[model samples]
Structures are given as C-alpha cells and as structure tokens.
Target: MVTSIILINAERTKINEVAEKLQEIAGISEVYSVSGKYDLVAIIRVKTNDDLADLVTNKMLAIDGIAKTETMLAFQAYSRHDLEAMFAVGM
Candidate 1:
C-alpha cells in the first residue's frame, strides 16, 4: 500500500466543505481539520504511485475551495496497534 499525507490550504470560508469533500474521496482514508500552517490534512492510501498521482492531480486538486496543497510520501508505517493486528503477538 502507498500512504501519503496531503496538507491543504483551502479558502478560509470553505475549510469544512473542503474536508467533507476530501473524506468522500475513495483513495483518501481520513481527513482532519487541524490548526497551524495548514487548514486540513488528508490521509491517502492507494495501491501505487500512479494511483496517488491521479488522485491528487485529477481528483483532489479539482475541488473548488482548495487553494494549495503539499503532499508527502511515507516510506514506512510504525503503529504498534496496527503491527500487532497484522502479525499477532510473539509471531
């Protein structure tokens, strides 16, 4: 699986709408409304890099309220809960 984090800057008045739209997208697993440099954070999970590119460029960027975005690719996942669920204890 390919995991990516997209930091989005949406029109100040449309943060909620933008987040809602992002959450509805197929490849985007989660959307968070956060405070700081960026207004919303979107978590994307896809099968390949090409799928990610298509999702970001073709789908995500086409949203009306989205002004700008910065996408980050993740090399590895490090979650104790997830690892345990996948591999079981002492495996």
Candidate 2:
C-alpha cells in the first residue's frame, strides 16, 4: 500500500467546499480544513504508485478552487506501542 498526504492551497473562501469535494474522490481517505500555509490537508491511500499519481493528477488537480498541493509520501511508521515494545526487547 502507498500513502500520501496532500497539502492543498485553495481559493479564498472555498476551503470547506474543496474539502467536501475531495472526500468524494477515490483514494482520498480523509480531508481536513486547516489554518496554515495550506488551506486543506488530504490523506490518500492507493494500491500502487500509478494509482497515486492518477489520483493527484487527474482527480485532485481537476477539482475547482484548488490552487496548489504538496504531496508527502510516508516511508515508515512507528506507534507508541511499537516504540514501547522495541525498548522492552532490549531490557
């Protein structure tokens, strides 16, 4: 599985609408309206890299009111429980 977090800069006054539209797109798992350099953040999960590319290029970029996007690809993840387990193993 491939995961991407897309930070979206939307047109003024269009954050909510843009976020709502993004939720309907395939591969988009979550969307949030945020206060920062970007207006919205979307979490996308796909089966392959090609699907991720298609989602960002065809679906997300095609949405109206979206000005720009920064995509971050996740490499590894460690939860609190995982960290505790790792530390305990060496004890």
Candidate 3:
C-alpha cells in the first residue's frame, strides 16, 4: 500500500465544499480544514504508486475549488508503540 498526505490550497469561500468533495474520492482517507499557508490537509492511501499519481493528477486536481497541492509520501514509520512491540519478549 502507498500512502500520501496532500496539502491543498483552495479558494477561501469554497473550503468546506471542497473538503467534502475530496472526502468522497476513493483514495482519500481523511480531510481536514486547517489554518496556515494551506487551507486543507488530506490523507490518501492507494494500492500503488500509479494509483497515488492518478488520485493527485486526475481526481484531486479536477476538483473545482482546489487551486494547488503539495504531496508528501511516507517512506517509513517509527512510532513509539511500534518500537516497543518490536523489542517485546517474544521469539
């Protein structure tokens, strides 16, 4: 599985509407309205790299209110819980 976080800059008046539309897309797992240089932040999970590309290029970019996007791909995770589990007493 491939996961990506997309930061979306949308038209000010259209933020909520755009966020709602993004939530309906297949690869988008989460969407939130945020305050900063960007208006919304979304989490997307797809089957492969091509799927991620399609979502960003074809789907997300096609949305009406979206102006621009910055995508970040997660390469590895090192959460505290994961580290503890990995070192647990088990063979």
- Model 2 C-alpha lDDT per residue in residues 1-91, reported as the tens digit of each score: 8988999999998878899999999899889888879899998889999999999989987889999999999887556854896889995
> Candidate 3's residue-wise lDDT over 25-50, tens digit each?
99898999888899999988899999
Q: Comparing 2 and 3 by lDDT, which wins?
A: 3
Compare candidates 1 and 2 on TM-score and give the better one. 1
Task: Supply the TM-score for candidate 3.
Answer: 0.83
Clash pairs detected, candidate 1: none
Best TM-score among the predictions, by candidate number: 1
| Weakest lDDT window of 10 consecutive positions for candidate 2 | 76-85
TM-score of each: 0.90, 0.83, 0.83
| Segments in model 3 whose C-alpha atoms lie over 4 Å from true places | 79-91
Comparing 1 and 3 on lDDT, the stronger one: 1
Give stretches of model 1 more than 4 Å off.
Answer: 84-91
**Would you list the C-alpha lDDT of every candidate in the order shown?**
0.92, 0.89, 0.90
